[model samples]
Target chain A: MTQPLTAGVSLKPQHYADALACRAEGLWFEAHPENYMAAGGPRLAWLDAIARDKPISLHGVGLSLAADEAPDEDHLAALKRLVDRYQPALVSEHLAWSMRRGVYAPDLLPFPRTQAALARIADNVDRMQEVLGRRVLIENPSLYLPLEGHDLGEVAFLAALSRRTGCGLLVDVNNVFVSAHNLGFSAEAYLDALPAEAVGEIHLAGHAPDANADLLIDTHGAPVAEAVWRLYGRLIARIGQRPTLIERDDDIPAFQDLMAERERAHALLTRETVDA
Target chain B: MPDGFHDRFLAAVGGDEAALAPWCAGPAASAGLAVYRNTTAKGAADALAAQFPTVERVVGPAWLAAAAVAHAADHPPRTASLLTYGEAFGGWLTTFPPAADMPFLADLARLDWLWTGAHLAADAPPLEATALARLTPESFARYRLVLHPATRFAGFDDGAPSLWQALQPPGDPPADLELGDAPEGLVFVRPGLDIDHRVIGAGTLAFLAGCGAGESLAAAAMDALAAEPGLDLSTVFAGLVAAGAFTELRTLS
Candidate 1:
């Protein structure tokens, strides 16, 4: 029987042996699907070996769902291939655009929150679900720029998006704290406003203060910060338990170190399960 | 309420701060814009560094990063799959003025790119020596060898192949990054998970080229002999078959 995914860490190639060997309770793994989109290779072999023992999640980084144009067909096809191969426990992407007119930027780019964007992103989400033949979770991006022209707040926009497309939300608590800090809003209020039932998954990662500015950049290079953990507590307290993931993409430590943080999230989740 | 806020945002991120003036709500846009700029540059450089490790080792991190930044300014990634990004990076290096002093850098990049290709190629059961033994010695001349799906080979006019092989792990660092005068060839093959690579000779290169081009075994043998006399034809054939180089041995009907 498939174990219920409680807490997970982003899988890295360096720690494949450890990831496969270590069998902690409710321990799963998540990987950026883009990295494994090749035809066949050692990477695929490694993923196959790991997925045999644990539930896997395919978190995409470059779908460009909110681009002015539709999601790239080839990208969608590649993602579908992985979904079919892995049969992951969860699949998620960001609520931001990274491609502009066939030219792709690496980062999850920001856009002015307007009525038109909401409609476009909703349509894009519909297309993605249609192609994958499954519901996907859309996570809010960490904001750095505050631009003009917002027809609705982010929470309302996300809530409406879920209602329209029958999709779910992957609420990244660190993003809430970072965006709230950069744009001068209350992170607690933002988390409190999210419709609890709409959240299907949660992401917790670290951030670094920009060297030149007072803003915090979503670097994902350090351990989870105290403030972000507080925000996570605030979120899960209201939303109940969800499949939480610890993401560390840069300056990665050994497998044991990441599992240490994963254990914290796991402990909280297990406690919630017990309390319920 | 402009029609193309996406376009304006794209322009702004492309380094034209004036394009976002109409929607500028605050004066703190400098740090944010700079942040985005830095992210984009970092993303491209990181991808390049990951894809071209050999090139980085030759040129060092600082030079590779600077070149990666300059290259991305004009040639941003065309697709979201960064695993195969920098397809033109090797060719582009030839145009870089700083890289002019290091002509071998481009060739090294090409070899690295080929290694990646072989690593990601589709899996197939390697051709075995036993399979070749099925055919009679006389009838083998009428057959052709089909190259493996995961087989990648490159022949250089100089010793770039040897230099690349020496730089791979589990080996001591070479004394210098100088190319040799003699020509050399490199072949990468993966029958299973682990990839196998080695320096080859002109005769083997010709034989493999013939096999890749669907030439008859006898024809390929002629080409190999023409490329290099005194080449042990039987020994080279058996070695290649053992290395998982060919997928099939077909008769040329």
Candidate 2:
């Protein structure tokens, strides 16, 4: 039976033991496949132990689906190996591109949302899904630079990509909020525009204010801000409940502290489901 | 001009201010561009820090972070798997003027790189002592043993391995790291979950090196003896076996 989707925390190496021992109802764990792409090691061992009891989501940060090229075959093979081994509850990549030629930037880079770019990314997503033999989720990237050549709004672009590729969306609410604030848009309208049925998972992560400018960088280094929480409540209320994850990549707190935030998300999700 | 958004954005991040003007509405867009540049720099720097903890310990975090950022610009990662990202860093440090005064720094970086390899190597059940004991004396000389995928070792002209071993424990590194005259051999292995290393002798180093090259047991022992005349081969061989260094054994036809 598929495990009931509920609020989960991003599994860090430090919190593996706690993650294994915790018996929170509907608690799941998410990790970046990039970190676990090893031939063998203690990290894989830890993930093995954790996945034995918990449902894992293999969220990838480096697939570079939006690159003006196909996904790397070796990278796809590695991801396939992990999927075959772990059988994660969901697999996800971002709408951003990180690799160009042979050099990788190690960040979720932006590109113009033009029709040609859309067709290329859709084709890339189709190849990724075909290679994995499963419908993967493509996430919306947080924008920083105000590029002028976008042919469609972020929501419309994502919706069109999902429609064409038959891939699900992993809506990062924090990313939506950050992108909206930085680019002068409405987070509410952006979330409203997404096809609710296409969203398989929702992500809530922390962002920090940029030091030099009035910009909110998606740093994932702090507790989820109140504004983002309000947006999360709104998104869950509209899209119904999905597998919401509280992602804290940098400056991770104690497992219990993170679980507290996760519990808040769980409570909200349960309340929304019950209300529905 | 419209299709050049990606190339222009990349160039702008690479520090070409004019490349982004085609995409940007005004000067205010530079702030957003700076955010991307800073985040990319941080990601590369953080990965380098994780891969080279010993280097970070020796040079201090701030200095190493700055150096990592600079190193990343010259040799950006070619893949998203940052685990294998800093392969060129040790060689790069050899030419870095700041690290030139510390002649041992490059070798130290190389040791750290090997340590990472050991840490991430494939998992396997180590060969048991009983497996080695079952080999007949007649066939022992003709047999070849496979080193564990996690096994890595290197020899240095000076005692850099000793200094590296001392700095392995997390604390304030010793104020003075003396380079002894005697050469040192370092062996890294992950027989289990955690990676461990030990100082070895020149003879053992040559034996392991020969074994890695698929030499017969007799040839490996000969190389060991040749490297260190009058060496006690039994002690070194038994120690490595006990360390879980070899994973498989087969007889050569």
The residue pairs that clash in candidate 2, if any, are none
Compare the candidates by DockQ and give the number of the best one: 1
Q: Chain B alone: TM-score in each candidate?
A: 0.94, 0.96
Alpha-carbon deviation at A192 in model 2, angstroms: 1.7
Each model's DockQ?
A: 0.83, 0.78
Estimate the overall C-alpha local distance difference test score of candidate 1. 0.90
* Residues A15-119 of candidate 2: C-alpha lDDT, one tens digit per residue: 988998999999999999988889998999999999998999999999999988889999999999999999999999999999888889989988888899999
lDDT by residue (B1-253, candidate 1, tens digit) is 6678778877887778778877763457767888888998899999999999888878888899999999897788989989999889999999999999989989999999988999888877888777777677677578999998889998999999988887887776587877998999999888888889889999999999999999988889889999999999999998889888888888788
lDDT of candidate 1 over A109-147, digit per residue (tens): 888778888899999999999999999999999998878
Which ten-residue region of model 2 chain A has the weakest summed lDDT? A1-10
lDDT of 2 by residue, B121-167 (tens): 99987767778786765676879888999999999999999989888
RMSD of each: 1.3, 1.3
How many pairs in model 1 have backbone atoms within 3 A of each other, for residues 3 or more apart or on separate chains, i.e. clashes?
A: 0
